[model samples]
Every structure is written in structure tokens, then in C-alpha cells.
Target: MRSLIRILTTVKELRWYYWGIIICSLLTAGTALLTPFIIKEATDEVVASLQGRGGGLSVVIWLAVALLLADLANTIISNVGGYLGDVMAARLRTRLSQLYFHKLLTLPQRYYDTALTGTVISRLNRSITETTQFLQSASNNFFPMLLTLVASLAITAWYSPWISLMLLVVFPTYMWLTTLTSKKWQKLEGEKNTHVDIAGGRFAEVIGQIRVVKSFVQEKRELASFSRHFDATVGLTRTQSRYWHSMDAARRGAMNLIFFGIHALIFVRTIQGVFTVGVMVLLIQLVNLAKQPATMMSYLVDTAQRAIAGSKDYFEVMAEAQEREGLADPVVGARKQLAPGQPMIEFREATFGYEDGDNVVRGVSFDIAQGERVAFVGESGGGKTTLVSLLLGLYQLRSGQVRVAGHDITETPAELLRGSVGVVFQDASLFSGTVRENIAYANPDATDEQIERAAREANAHDFIMGFEHGYDTLIGERGLKLSGGQKQRIAVARAMLKDAPILVLDEATSALDSKSERLVQQGLDRLMQGRTSVIIAHRLSTIASVDRIVTLRDGKVDEIGTPEELAQTGGIYAELLALQSGSKRDRKKLKDFDITA
Candidate 1:
């Protein structure tokens, strides 16, 4: 009931179309039910004419004309009602989709982490379409059916009240049956959707991580897993379908019993001379009209239940609390000239965690002064990424505060703060677009000259020009066509072009080969200059001479100093350096690469 009400409220704005539908539906019902009475009048006129009653021929001709007019009106009204239904269905679908997509964009990042990709996509794509179809079917075919049922009963009761009593009693039983059957179908539909979600999520997860699957030779195992879910989904759906067939059969059987019994009663009454031919015809027509709603009861209930069941996930998404709005939008159009002094970025005893868990990064404090370069070097899973996440305002702080340019992260609008910070991640993600567009992503409205300059600075100009279409050539999904260094360089160019006051380099060169590493390292050096930069340092050599290095141990800040000072102390930072020193190849490469200098 709540679901139906929600759908009504959503489409309430388009009530005029519904009003149009209602009017046409009433016209259609009136025209159809009136046919039996008109035909009976014509038959009586003919009988009188055959018997040589005076004035019979003229009355019979008028009666014939009336029946023909009723048929034409019925056809026209039905067509108009159907057309209005189509219009209402279209509006419902379009509006519901808009609501869902708008809600999706406002949800926080954690929602994506916990949710399955396949389930999310399915709900977004199919929920609105199915819901509106059910609503339209109800309004067009099932809802308007009441007009036929009600008018038939009134006319029949005028002739014989006993028959109307039987109809009233039978209506409730069918409705009860429909309600009971619908409850079971709704649960089954939910199970079916769950199985489908698993299958789709598994397929997408495997494909997206195909490299890992191939490396580990687990493709056969993954296929088996996916097949199991698919088979289960099919088996369950078949069972549900069989159940629906049985209910449909039951509905039809019930309608037939009512039709035959009514006809039998009318025949007996006619023979008794208590009922005339016209009264019998009216009863028969009314019985058939009552059957319209009964005949469609099972289908109407099933479709409504299925649509509501499918929307379970869709409603859950809308119910999720949206990310808080930031205090301001990005300050663009004209660049602000920032005066250099003090820490541009600061954290004081900041802490954060997921859900009810203990803080993943705790009691951390640091400062990046304007135009100063700093690196955070730590072992894997040592809270290096958490600190970066805090800086980016990806996670709300569990305690304390993260201040960017003297504004608390929570108070500052995300886009406003992020606009000043350009990030280059280790896993460089590029959309399917031309080289020029990809580089210009940071500033979509950047001029061609600005794009070329950034490309040259990142050392991406020559490679971009090498393509036949150059900047116009299409890069495939995730920029798979480009080599590792080429992708990294483009990412560097994008960040550089933003020309933000703060720069973040998240393992920018760690994933590249030795030759590729050197090229990418050069690009990073140019991007880091004259800005407040924080490097999530993995390759220790690159940040050996940075302004400072912060070493983390077990979610807490352990040490902070220059590389030389930390190496001399034999602290956590020294231990990390020693671990890398044992690898002579890493040592030689570090020596060859002078990235920070």
C-alpha cells in the first residue's frame, strides 16, 4: 500500500493525463454496457413488427441505429483511453529515472564499497521501467474496470437484487485469493533478483580483474561460480512461473463458474414468467462485465507485486543519507593569488575509522607549508592511504579536524577545496576520450594553447602527436591502448594543467618499468614545484631530499624529519630505508633517478 502511494505521489504532477484516462475509461465502460440494453430493445421491436403490431417498423429502425452508434462510440472511447495510458506511462518512467539518478549522484563513496556493482546497475536501469509499467497497467486496465463492474451491478439490481447480492459476496473472495497469492510471489521475486545480482556482480568483478584471474589461472573456477548462480536463478524463476500459471487457471475457473451459474438462474426466472427477455439480456451482459475485473485480478495483483519487489533496492538507495554539502563551490573563472606563508595544509590530532571500528589513522598531525614538498613514507597497510583520504576529504573525520588553507575540511565544500588540490594516483584512470580531451579533463574549458603547454611540460606532446589523428584519436576504455608511461604522463599533464595550489602524488612512478619510471619521474618533478605537495612515497629515492618525511607506524605518526636526519636516527624511517637498501637493484635505480632534486 505504501509503495502504491509513493508511486501515486511521484506521478501526481501528471494528474491531468490520469484525469483524461479516467474520463475516457468511463465513456468506454458506459458505451460497452449500454450495448446489451440497446440490442434487446431492437429485438423487441422486431418481434412486435412480425406480430403485425402498429408503429413497429419505425421503432425497430431507430433501435438498430442506436445499437450501431453504441458500438462506434465504444471503439472510439477505448482507443482514447489507451492513448492516455501510454502518455501517463511515459511520464512516470521519465520522472522516476530522474529521481533515481539524482539520488545516486548524491550518495557517499562507502555505499559503492559495500554494494555489488551488478545489483546497483540493475536497480538503476530496470526498477523505474517495471514500476511504471505496473502502475500504467493498473490505471488503464484494472482501475477503470471498476466502472464496468459498478454500472453492471446497478442496472442488474434494478431488475433483480438477488443476482447483485451473489456478485458482491463473490468479489471479496477473489480479492482475498489475489492478496494471498501476491504475498508469496513478492518474496519469490526478491529471491530471484538476489540471485541475478550475484551472477552479474561476479561476472563484472571477474572481467574487471581479468589480469589477476589470468595470472593465477582461475578463469575456469570463476566460470563455474558464475554458472552455479545462473542455474539457481533459472530454477527459482521457473518455480515462480509455475505458481503464477496455477493462480491464473484458478482465476479463470472461478470466473467461468460465476458466468454459467448466473446464466442458469436467468433462464429459470424467464421460464417462470417473472423475468422478460430484455431483463435476461441485461443480466447476461452485467455478468460478463463483472468478469472483466475478476478475469484480470490475478495479473493485476502479480504485476503490482513484482514491480514493488524490484524496487526494494531502488528505495534503499534513495533512503541512504546523502553526503553533506560543502560550504562553497570551486573558486574558478579567475584564479586567486595566494600569498606564501605558514602551513597551507594542516592536521591536528586528526583521526578516522569505518563504522564502529577503531580508528584506522589516529592522533596524526602534520603541516605542509606553502611551496614546500613533503613525503609520507610507510609500509603497506600502515595508514599511508588513510592520511591521503583524510586530506582529500573522502572520509569524514571521526575526531579532531583536517584544515585545508585554514578552513576545516568538514566546513569547506569538497569541490571548493579539491579544486585547489590536483592529484595523480598510482592507478591512473582515464575515460574513453581523445588525448587532448583526457589532458584537458582537469579544466574542461582550457584553451588549446594551455593544453599544449601542459602536455609539453609532462613530456606527453611527442607521443600524442605520433598518432595519425593526434589529439583527436579515440583512446579505448581505461586508456588500455596507451603504454604504462604514456598513461602516467597524460595523468601528470592533467594535474599540471589544473595548476592547483596543492599537488598530491600517490605512488605516481611506483608501477612503471625502469625506463618508464625515469620518464614519469621527470614529469612528477615539474608538477611538484612551487606548490604545497604531499607525496605518498613508496620509491624512497624520489623523496630523499624533500623538505620533510613523515613515517607512520600502526596508525600513529612515528617520526618526522628530513631523510638524512631520519636515516641517522635508526628509527622506523631508518628501518624502512634499510629494507629497500638490501635490494641492490633498487639502490642502483634510486641512485640513477634524481627525481626530488
Candidate 2:
């Protein structure tokens, strides 16, 4: 209930919608109860007129007018109530989706690494959908049914006490079974949703990595894996349906039997001159009111329970602790921005590990003055990439200080810190967008001339123009339409267009052949000319002209100096160079980085 209340509280802005539903619901309930009395008065009026009593045709006209007014008002109010409910549901759904998506962006890097995109996507969508569904059922079905049920019983007791007394005897058993089935359905729904999401996850995983699946020739294996999830979902749904239908069959049968039993007793009393035609009419209408709620009870509970179960997953994500900007000073609403006199990049006694007291990067410190090109080279898992993560404010530091443009990284806003630097990763990730959109991704406001200049600097201008649409051509997903070299060049071109004060290139040329490598290297040269550049050198040749080469071994800085200077030291850099130039056996050792000459 608290969880349900928390979900409701998020839409405080739409309180008017909720209030409107309640007001209309009350009016509708009142009108429905009045229906029995209106019939009773009409029946009495007709009989009295037929028997030539004091009442005449005037009574029938007044009763007809009252019934018409009540029904018309009820119809208008119910329609308005339904409209408000839909509006509230839409607002809640949109709000929840925004919350989930925004949280996805704010969550730490580790969350993404461990989380499956398919599973998360399914949960996010289902949570919002289910939460709104639950709200609607509660408002439209559960609450209304309950209110109507109470009013119907009172009217039944007033018309015929014996029938109402019989209702009291049967109500408890009906409610007990309904409550019991509702709980079971909720549990089943929760389990079914989990399996359903797993099925969605499997579908996403197999399709997203279709290239890998095809290369591995694992079509049969993948299909079998997907089939397992599908079958489980089907089996659970079948069981749930069986239980539901069986319970419904029982509920309807019992309610109908009770209904007829009361009817027979009423008929007997009427034949014995104990009740008039008007009284009989009122009893039938009142019985039907009771039966309506009784019949709908299971369905309403099923919808409500399913909704609550699904929304649980949604609200769980909403409650996640959000990461906020750390202030340099204890001042309210003071955001950290670029402060003057900070180094282009500085790491002081920096030590970091994914887990506590376990450092993957230990006590490493470095400085890259403005416009200096430095390269980081190391064996795999020696924390070459972790350093970039630290500088970018992607991870929280275990200890020490990382300052970027003079402001502490933790103190600076992540968006501003990243905006200050341009990056070209080896993967060459591009969206399913046009060439123009992809190039101007970082700076959407860049002029056409600036975009062309960046493309020319990247050696991508000529090839891009070769397409009939030029910059307007669709690149497809992750730029699949382009070759590896074309993709990397475009990625570099994108970085060039960003034109930040600092640049980081992680093995930017590792995947390119010699001809493509030379082209991309020239583009990189143009891009890195005046920026503070950091390169993670996978190939020894790529870092030959760097101002300094920082060697890392076992998570600490092994050595730092020029390539020529390190070549003479017989250290890790020298050892790497020797190994690369050695026999075929030594070549396999550095194959991960693919730095062959």
C-alpha cells in the first residue's frame, strides 16, 4: 500500500484529474441507486392509474421526467469521469517513462555494464504501462464497484430484509475466494512479467549481436535459447488463464444460484399477498445491483493486482539514489564550473579500483600541459583506459584528486567536463542518422562550412561527396553503410568538429590498414595540432612523435619520457619494442593491441 501510495504521490500535479474522477464517480453511484426508486415510483403510478385510484396520468409524466433527467445527468458525468481518468493515466505514464529514461542517463557506468539493454527496456516500458493500468482499474473498477456494492446492499435491505440477510451470509465466502484468487494472480503476474522480460532480453541480445551470431554460425543455438524463454512465458500464461477461468466459472455459478434462490422466495411472498407489483419490481432491480458488483469482483481484482505488481518494478528504479554535482564549497545551489588557473589536466596521488581497497590504478600521477601530445602505452589491464574514465568523471575516485582545467573533477559538472574535451574511440560508434547529423552531433549548431572543413581535415569529404546525397545520405545503424576506414574517419571528423581544447584518442588507428591508417593519422595530426592530446598507444608506431610516452606496468607508472629516451632505458617500452621486432612467438603477446609495423 505504501508503494502504491508512493506511485500515486508522484502525480501531485494532476490532483485535479483525480478529484474529478472521485466527484463524477460519487454522482454516478448516487444515480445508479436512484434507478431502483425511480422504477418503484413509475410501477406504482401505472398500477394506481389502471385501478382508478386518486393518482392519475400526471404522476406517470412526473416520474418519466425524473428518470430522464437522472439518466442524462449520469451519462454526462460518467463520460467526463472517463475522460479525466484517461488524461491522468497518460500523464502518469509519460512522467514515469521520463523518470526511467532520465535515470538511465544518470546511473553510474557499472550499472550499464551489468545490466542487459533488453531487460531494462522491457521493465521500463512495462512499469509505466502497468502503473497507469493499475491506477485506472482502482479508480474505475475497484473503488466504484465497492461503493456501488455498499449502496446496493442498503437499498436491498430497505426493500426486502430477508434477501439482504441472505446476501450477508453469502458475501463473506465470495469475498474470501476473490481475495484468495487475487493474491495468487498477483504472484503469478509478477513471475510472468519477469520471464516475459527475460524473453525480451534474449530477443534484443540475439538481434543486437546478429553479426557475432552469424559469424559463430550459432543460429540454431540462439533459436533454442529464445525458444526456452518463449515457452516459459506461454506455460505460465496458460496456467494463469486456467486458474482465472475456473475461479470465474465458480464465482458466476454461485452468484447466479443465490440470485435465483432469492427470486423464488420473492415470488412466493408476492403470491401470498405479502408484496405488490411495485415492491417486486424494486426487489428485482436492487438484486441486480448486488449481482453486478459480485459478478465483476474477480475481474476488477485481477486488473488491480496485475497493475500493482508490474508497477513495483517501475517505482524501484525511481527510488534509486541519484548522483549530484559535488560543490567545492558548502554553498546552496552553487554549481561547479570552469575556474581559472587550473592545469589542462592533472592527477595527484590518484588511486582507483572498481571495488574498495583493490586498486586497478594505484597512486598514479601525471600532468599534460596545454597543447602537449602525450601517449599512454601499457599491457592490457594495466589501467590505460581506466585513467581516461577517471579524467572524464565517469567513475568516483577511491582516493586522490583529479583536476581538469583547474576545477576538481568531482566538483565540475560531468556534461561541462566532457564538453571541454573531444574524444575518438577505436569502435567508431555512429547512430542511424544522416552524414550531416552524425558529423554535427557534438555541436548541433555548427555551420555547414565548419562541418565541411572538419570532414576535409578527416579526409572524409571526398568520399562523403561521392554519395549522390553527400551529407544527406543515411549512414544506417552504427554507420554500417560505411567501411571501417570510412567510419573511423567520420568519427575523427566528428571529434574535429567538436574542436575542444583537449583530445583523447584510444587506439584510433589500430583497425585501419596501412593506407587507411596514414589517411586517419593525417586527420588526427590536423585535429591534435593545438589541443592537449592524450593517446592510448596500441601500436608503438602511432606514438613515435608524442611529446612524452607514459609507460604503465601493474597499475602504476613504470616510466615517463620521450619515445627515443625510453628506447635507450631498456624498460617496459624498450622491452615492448624488442618483443614486437622479435620472432613469431613474441608477436602473439602483443596481438591484443595489434601494434605490428
Query: 470, model 1: CA deviation in Å?
Result: 2.0
Worst 10 residues of 2 by lDDT: 329-338
lDDT of 1 by residue, 1-597 (tens): 587667767668988987898898899888988788987676655656677873666787787788889999988888788888888888888887888888877776677768878667767666677788887887778766788899888888888788887777667777766666777778888888787778888787887788899999999999999898889878988988898778777766776777677778889998898876766776777787887787787777777777787566667777898767855535332124434564687889998887778888889998878778888866566788788878887788888888877677787666777777899999889889899899999899999999999999898889999999988878888898999899999999999999988889888887888888888888889888887889886566778768998888778888999888999888766766665656765454334221221
What is the C-alpha lDDT profile of model 2 across 1-597, one tens digit per residue? 466677778768888888888888888888877777899889987887888883777788888899998888878877777878888888888887887899888877767766788999989877778778878766765565567677877877876788998776567767776776777777778788888788788888888889999999999998898788778878888988899888878776787788788999888888887878888888888777777777776766666676678778876777765555553432111123234444578989899988445899999998877778999988788889999888877888888999876767788767777878889999999999999999999989999999999999999999999999999999999999998899999999999998788899988988888899889999999999988899986678889899998888889999999989999999878888888789888877776443554
Off by over 4 Å in 1: 11-13, 54-73, 211-216, 238-255, 326-342, 583-597
How many pairs collide in each candidate, listed in order?
Answer: 2, 1
RMSD of 1: 3.7
lDDT of 1: 0.79
Top candidate on lDDT is 2
Distance (Å) between predicted and true CA of 421, model 1? Answer: 2.9
lDDT of 1 at 487: 95
Each candidate structure's TM-score, on Cα atoms with residue i matched to residue i, is 0.89, 0.89
